[model samples]
Target: MFAEFRKFVMRGNVLDLAVAVIIGAAFATITKSLTDDVIMPVVGWIFGGFDFSSYFIRLGPIPEGYTGSVNNYAALKEAGVPLLGYGAFVTTVINFLILAFIIFLIVRSVNRMLARFEHQKPEVPAAEPTDVVLLREIRDELRKRPAE
Candidate 1:
């Protein structure tokens, strides 16, 4: 059983999947930082410095004895306030779009590279079928014999 498990784990596809998952996770972190720190800030600056993540609709009353500001979404949520955080949803959508576009570009470039390699490959002629070879051999043998 242990050997079977090891064999399963050692398969090329399994190892490739594991590596892809790790790299994908790291790429997601970088994408998130790009969305949150760089792109969103520039977008906010263009739109009069309004933060998208702070836009929310309060669905319920704020908890009593809450010292945090009412306009702050994170603080209000921490104080058990029921709120619809649409701004955060928008930010998440943007992040997903960016990540998807980047992945698409990478796949497209890789496909183009693969196409170039395919075109560069030297073409080898296919071998004749067994029946065709045998027929040719019989024809040659008959041609060598005396006319009958």
Candidate 2:
């Protein structure tokens, strides 16, 4: 059982999957940073500095001892207030779109590069061996001659 488990773990596909998972995790982190730190801030500025994360509608009455800001979604949730978090949802959708667009661009570029490489490949036919050529010539001569 131990040997079977080791074999499963050591397989080429398994190793490739593990590497892919690690790389995907790293890529997700980078994309998240790009969305949150760089793009979101610029977008916020362009849209007059509105924060999407804090945008929520409280559906239920606030708890009696709650002193947190009414506009804060996290605070309201902590206070056990039922709320609709559309702003957070919108932010997540935007992030997904950006990430998907970037990935599409990357795949497109890779495909184009692969196509170019294929186009540039040489199409010269392989040279026939001298022995095969001589044998063919003999065969042709025999065919041309009458039977003895």
**Candidate 1 segments exceeding 4 Å error:** 130-148
- Candidate 1's error at 38, in angstroms? 1.1
Query: Model 2, range 86-145, lDDT digits (tens) per residue?
Result: 867767788788878988999999999999999999998999999999999999999999
Residue-pair clash count for candidate 1: 0
In candidate 2, list every pair of residues with a backbone clash. none
**Could you tell me the TM-score of candidate 2?**
0.77
Best by TM-score: 1
- The lDDT of each candidate is 0.92, 0.84
Off by over 4 Å in 2: 45-49, 124-135, 139-148
Given candidate 1, what's the lDDT at residue 123?
A: 98
Error of 2 at 14 (Å): 2.3
Tell me how many residue pairs clash in candidate 2.
Answer: 0
Alpha carbon lDDT at 84, candidate 2: 93
